[model samples]
Target: MRQQNHKNTFLKTIPFTSIFVEALKQSSMWVSSNYIDGNSQFQGKLLLKVDSQWESVQLNLHPEKLYRKGVGSDDYTSYCQLQACFLKKFTHFDPTMPNYRYGIRLQFGQQLSHLLCENSDVFKKWFQFLRRFCIMDKFARKYKVLGKIKQCDPVFGQCLFSCVRVQDAEYHVVKVIDKNVITAGQKQNLYRELSNLRKLSQTQICYIVEVFEDEQSVYILYEYYLGIDLRTYIKESQIYQMAEQSSQGLDEKLVADILYGVLQAIQHMHSKGVFHRDIKMENLFIPEKKRLPFVVLGNFCYSETTDSTQYKKCGTPGFVAPEIFRSKNYTSKVDLFSLGIIFYLLVYGKLPFEGKDQEEILRSNEKCDIDFKFEKKICKKISISGMDLLKGLLNKEPIKRLSAAQALNHHWFIKMGTRNQRNQYLQVQRGKSLSTIIENSVDITQSYYQSNSQLYQSTKEDDKLDRVEKEFIKGSLYDKLLYFNSIQYQPSKIRRIQQST
Candidate 1:
């Protein structure tokens, strides 16, 4: 009977392994190895292991190039095949396939345009590739042309050209492309920009997968971050809401750490004169861990270089700074203001300005009519210092608002009581210079999450910061937001005074 039981367990494990391997083979993303010369289709044996169990799989990827003689060719052939290995285990079966259909998506929308705009030639190639790629449409037909643009002879386009997922610690090549292009020069331009960004972010941001350009459109290759976003993290992951909620809950320090890292990235962009006009919870991506929550400032369609304004009114409603709508001219401070709102959400797990419509939210944002008092009441566990920091950051006046640098240096965050001492701890924690702490912190949460409550208290005093802490410890999603809809959102006195003035 013992032997029979053991054999039964082995038999069950075999089916699980078989399902895993088959799912990998049929997955949209499968790693393709074995380099080749031209457009050739090939498959390679891939090994995947979960926990302690191991399984073998296959990868189907092809090397193709958009070659335009005298113009350019894809710099590397196998560049498109690398997909993240984590996704396969989680989302192996197709939604439309038999039985398995579990998957979550993380996308970089407006940000793609901003990243591609750096090189003109590449941008064109990317545009063409976007138009020419065969993507699935509502009709279930694989069509190359999803839409069209009127720039320089009506260009065609699609939503996304390439899709990738991480399954095991490696990338799987899910899709291959047939060549179509505006030019070879454009193709090379895309490759160069992607390569540069990837290289620069290799250590700073590891989750962003490298992009590749084929004949049709520029394909942004990225691994699926198998977790919820900040918005969901705030709503579902509330400690109190765990049982009643459907989403994951997060910790308080984890929320602050993610916010701090996001501020650091925005600060870096400010240093480079790049303004991510779109800053919101949806734009902030959370990793599987709280400390290493991934907040990417995506949707750069409204982003502006220090010297350009051809693009106008390119931001989401609630998060868009008032100046963008009121003043034609704006700067990186706009992104800073939005970051403040995001910080508020991270700490309080609630939107600063709640209204029934876009006009109301915009009016509130423009008027700076956010009620910290109510936030104070709801977040009874937060510290005063943390609340002060949030108040300063969420200030309506861009000038009055905390710059990313200043926010980082706020007395609230000064645990050791001196800039130098605090800077040292921050550097050690971030693994970079004090100024680059934000960048360093971005990658740490993915691998490390150490709670330092006393350190956090000594550093920053946010009265409501404790609410995030409480939520992290024992709050539930429904409990954290139980009052969100019922509570009346009123503007603070300072905001009223400013408006009156």
Candidate 2:
């Protein structure tokens, strides 16, 4: 009796037709009859209401048939705020719409229908009420699983851990995309990434182990990596300690090995016609335990196939290529440019082109004035051949840049030491521990020279010295001069230099 009274109260609050309410009760499917199709311009469909000319359409709101629903824009930029408000009101409703005009897209199998209501307020109420009947009850019956929320961020949404019974055994590490707020474009991108991951056969790349989805969320089980991202690894390794003390940057051989692994993974992706537009240190993961040169590449949200021709600007600021800024169509070379930036960071412990802000960074990228010389001062141990490879990878002209295949064949990679040599270098790098040096000296001239030397080495390296001499020059002039002075001005070395000149 109390349940019937509650039902009556719900029916009174929602101004919907009895036939619609009966249909919902019968099928356990939700339909919002409160929304009167405001557009009189919609042709071909017969008007359901002669009194108001408001058209009504039958929609099957099943979990398997419904792809996604959103208002105003597919990207959900227009109705995001409105959707958020609706989500707050109706906790079960996963609002994927952008806050703009009142337009809703209902996709059922291959058929798609667009419904435009009067305003945002009406649309919000419509979606909020719809959630009551549109709950994933059928989905709950299909998959019996237990899970817990792992991480939740506003932008990326929640990362949940679930265990599924497969062949009488449980599989863990399943990613659950629950009622967390996310855009429709992001939802589509998730599906696209999953599809692409399924197509890939490479073991080096991160791939989905299993996939399961209900009406409310998506569950993706991916192969796990027991390590930190490259960005954090670089910080923890203290590769920049060389700036203050007599330490060294990352070894050239180790850098080569890492790049080699990255290139192989990229080669596999390219062969599959997929390009990872956003390649950065944050996306690359290195194992905590010694895995030699192997590094896992994750985050395929910004990746695209080679055949895709749309030229919208996307990617992180410093790593974004010049062509993307110019709004010109680009190819897989964009990934190469981004890879070059990562490679430069690995070698120099800093970006090749940097600015105070995003705009400045983009401007620097546009100019493409890479500072190869600065690398010499900070990283004195790097080989000339390595610098040449950096130049090839970082070339502004996409056509001129070395392809992944060509990069693999470069002299630097060709001369790369054996796996044992790389392992030994990694061990040495791990062993060297340096305390963080703070600049406490007040001497103006001494501090000025030190700061200028670091800056001048970074910004004016190419302008001050010729590339040919830079390649041959071993260590710094200070070290060479100290050796010469210790030898009491060796005439034989001076004669050899004069002969060479």
Candidate 3:
């Protein structure tokens, strides 16, 4: 009788042990739960299972009313939270209970429900697990509607881009902006961008493809381009030319073509009363497989309409115009100044004015101290017209700077060689190695930094002396007399005092 009783006890314990083991495995997979359904007044267990093609959740309790079947986990939105004090009061209030009450909130379109759990640890783990699935589900549903997210593109601010398919045959780029990070100011800027993009009609400019929003984020779809930005392309080309012992850095014709395209785009924007306040090489995209002289201008976050005159100081550090620094009203010529910088970069593969830091660089811009003589040394084959155009664009006075139309009609673009001539000029011959070119460029930059440093120090000393003189002039008569007396009697008085001591 004792042996039979022991056998019965052991057999009863086996089921509980198996259930615990199963729960542990489910938790490891990040989906274990029991919840009370207030609407049905029925308790149920929720289990999520993912396979090669489907992600489904099974609710153990049968309901009197069936809402829908074959619904994927992605269809429901999930949120986890601790039970509020009021909720506990309304429900089962257990003051002696050690564990906290938690719940998973679910939303399917307009429908809402909550799954109540008793354990805090389980709530946290389940919440995290469910939230990830929610995001995954969101993306999966988007794939069905907007095609699949193929790959990630360059990320800017709180926005990211992915290569996405729109139709079965068409691929485009989609910008994802998290609504959680959108501030009031940023929202205004986004509105401006949308307005500006809508007003643009130029083929050279990149326009918005589509705009949509979900609960958590906004999506701005863009037409995809099969190329890198001008900055990356130029840097890569320089590296390649250096490695290949090419006599030329880049084809001047190609450079002219890129400039022409950018100028046209700017002209188009300007014609519409839109000013691209921030224009840099990074904003210009060129084709990866060059069939023609194609370029597209993008990134309109800083762009503004001309009707708004009260402008804040905004732009990339080196590319910003001098008037912007003075807090003065600036015109579209600011873009011209930036264009000049780009022109200089394309020609010489270096910035006209650089410093150890941004402050010094701004000071250099204020002084309009640029080295135009370096062009001949850098590119001996470049024509006088090219240099002249560069000078016109880079002119310090915005009023005197060349407009986009003027630059387009400039002799440099008109007289630039044919494709064959450009190819001939770009042909590789005996030249400096990649290492040698980079070293030379570095040496020049370092020398410029050293010179700027010395000049800065001298200017600082002069300012110090000027300050001393101004202070002396502003001093009271008694203070002035005391200063002079100290200067006159300091050495002799010190000797006499020492002797007395």
**Distance from true location, Cα of 305 in model 2, Å:** 0.4
C-alpha root-mean-square deviation, candidate 2 = 19.8
Best-first order by lDDT: 3, 2, 1
lDDT digits (tens) for residues 1-501 of candidate 2: 654654343223211222112222332222223222221111211111223343543332221122122223232111110100111111111134232235444222222234444455756655543332222122244344566644332236556454555454544455666634655666656645654564455656876554443445555666655366778766776656744365554566777888878887888888777888888888887755646467888777677777677756888888988888776588888888898898888766678778899888888887888867564444546655566667667777787676887666443554465344323433333422111000111111234335323322333434443454343233344443444345423445444544565
lDDT of 1 at 273: 49
lDDT by residue (1-501, candidate 1, tens digit) is 654664343323111111112222433332233344432233333233324332333323332221111113323222221211111111232233333222211112111000112233433443333222111111112223323222110111333332323233343112222244334543333333232232222112223343333224334444443345556665674643542242333344444556666766776666554566777766665545433544554323244555564435646666777777777766677777777777665555566777899888777767766655552232334444455567666666666666787766553444213224343553344322222333232111212123212222223324324464434223333442343223311124323443555
Any idea what lDDT model 3 has? 0.53
Q: Model 1 Cα displacement at 474 (Å)?
A: 34
List the global CA lDDT of all models. Answer: 0.41, 0.53, 0.53
Q: Candidate 2: minimum summed lDDT over ten consecutive residues — where?
A: 79-88
Reference-based lDDT, residue 282, model 3 = 82
Q: Best to worst by TM-score, what's the order?
A: 2, 3, 1
Candidate 2 TM-score, true structure as reference: 0.54
- Among all windows of ten consecutive residues in candidate 1, which has the lowest summed lDDT? 107-116
Off by over 4 Å in 3: 1-158, 239-249, 288-292, 375-378, 417-501
Candidate 2: which pairs clash? 76-98, 78-98, 78-99, 78-100, 79-98, 79-99, 80-98, 80-99, 374-457, 374-458
Against the true structure, candidate 2 has what lDDT? 0.53
**Candidate 1 vs candidate 3, TM-score winner:** 3
